[model samples]
Target: MNTRSPWTVVICAAAVVTLAMGVRQSFGLFLPQMGPALDIGRSDFGLALAIQNLMLGLAQPFVGAIADKHGAGRVTLAGALLYVAGLVGAAYATDAMGIHLTLGFMVGLAMTGVTFTVMLGAVGRVVPPERRTMAFGIVTAGGSVGQFLVVPGAQLLLGQLGYHMAFIALAGLIGLAAVLAIGVAGKPRALDADGPAQSVGEALREASGVRSFWLLNAGFFVCGFHIAFIATHFPAYLADKQIPPAIGATALALVGLFNIFGSYAFGLSGDRYPKHYLLAGLYAARGLVFVLFLALPLTNVTALAFAAAMGFLWLGTVPLTNGLVSQIFGVRHLSMLGGIVFLSHQVGSFFGAWAAGYMFDLMGSYDAAWIASIALAAMAALVHLPIRDAPLVRRPLAA
Candidate 1:
């Protein structure tokens, strides 16, 4: 029997997520500086983030499988080192290709090893089912914490240290998460199955057959699109309106701050209510928020209010979506299965990040993207309604 406390796993995993995601949220803040410095357009910078999101999604299955079979600690440690490398490399990069390689390629692969797939999987394995969603909320909130705290710090670094030295500083911060990897170091425990332990192929095949899984993926895609577009482009979008840059940073920071509570509230509620229903409501609320934000006057107060509202809704989907996955398919192969679902989310992120910039370059406004967000929100709200939230009942192979 394992001796480590479940909370230990949660704390360590959350800490790592905080650093990984915090540094990540800070990237959009870099675009203002990077664009002028590298002589690149918004689309160029957007493409780099697009590549990173796509690469992260593409690599997740393998990384999750590795973590599932071997141990999360090793995977996390390696990812942390690679994350440092990517940041440091991006620091020195002078061209589009160079930024794409360092920031897009290397960091993308690194995230698979460090972020939600492996970390949440670790918690799923350790925390009891009754408490699993709450644990997920705590971990999901860690990313926001990073955003709240790290984004502003990154802004300060950018203003003071410039992008190069700022990146180097960020590298050192993520390097610390490498050591915390030890806290999550353990292989998946054998789960109770109808037959022998399911092979990775078997897990894939089973999840593929579940209709709700695909629906969950579709819903998550909207989430990815919304977050990727907003996180990467929202700062610049604000700058276009002649808003002070500091307000943009504060707006993102508020998102991070409020999401902490939102994640926890949603996570706690998931344990008490129907997860799919909660997810549906969350998406619907997001749609309403967007509508209000767009309809209101564009002022700093309105922007910050929008951020706070969006923040509460943000990342709440993570624990809820993940809870649905675990609720449907047990945690036996949670990492790999969740990774597949997340891959769908990342694909949307690629489009969201790239498309906004493309639209900006072509149309001179983010109006189209914002409208798309509203529509996607409506779609996501509808999609989760049909998901089958019951646990899967397995039949013995010999039956």
Candidate 2:
């Protein structure tokens, strides 16, 4: 088999992923205005987002399975259109059910195409094995780039054109992601990444017996908690404490910005070191950061600085974790299996996002959520230790 141009693949992946994730991340910015416009409580807003996350996770396995069989171009193109439709629907949604259906189901369904597991599966297929981890890092970084750069810009656009127009504009940009997905065809041509390809069912069965896969899943639940809880609630948490809204936005964007560097750095590290140990350390570091942030005085500067540091470490684990999955399980059914693992991540996200809001509503403070994060992080660190980094014990694929 011949290799494709690295630059072309990387650039295309970055462009497409940035547009997709950029739009997704902007949802938080809308919360400030959206909650009021709809006559809903913050918990309601959180629940809607939690539903979106849940549907996103639930849809992933089927999407990944289909992508593994049918190639990603069609699915990606379809997802782009669905994404645009979902956003437009959201702009007009006047009731709770409308928001849930349009934003949760429709938008979440669209996310199946753009999310890291499926997107990185395509990346894993094209890039040589030696370059896979680094390549995945670069692509994942694009999503962060979108979050950091595009979100503030979207806020600016909203400033000028208003919320509805801002969303409409984003819909158009999301359509561009579909256009770019068409260009990512050299990889997943046959949906085969390794020498001997296994069926999706066979792959799942094989991986089910692996102790490490379950550990990875359990640990990833914590990751979801940190990401979604912060993404959905952090802004409000600061606002409740009298921090400026821009400060909140800035801190979140900072996470996206710094992660660009952190993701790449971790990917490079994964290339050389034991990925599980690195994963353990990343989770442990997350616990430490949260502990310190909660214990000290909260200020805009401290919040933003914390965001920047945490952001670097945030999505960085994705490349490392995904790389580890491919390393242990091979790439035959990588997309499907990886989707299952990510489902755990998203399940955690649902709870993280929902629980923070719920806790705040109940206690009038975010103390419980913060404490849970520290505990979950520590648990995730422990979970990573026993995952033996070896290939799945499997019967050969029927070829």
Question: RMSD in angstroms, candidate 1?
Answer: 1.4
Please give, for residues 322-349, the per-residue lDDT of candidate 2 as tens digits.
9999989877667788888889988998
Tens-place lDDT per residue, model 1, 138-194, is 999999999999999999999998999999999999999999999999766565112
For each candidate in turn, the TM-score is 0.98, 0.95
Candidate 2: global Cα-lDDT?
0.83
> Which candidate number maximizes TM-score?
1
Kindly provide the TM-score of model 2 when superposed on the true structure, using C-alpha atoms: 0.95
Model 2 per-residue lDDT at 253:
85
Instruction: For each of the candidates, give the backbone clash count.
Output: 0, 0
Task: Give stretches of model 1 more than 4 Å off.
Answer: 191-196
| Highest-lDDT candidate | 1
Residue pairs of candidate 1 with colliding backbone atoms: none
List pairs with backbone clashes in candidate 2: none
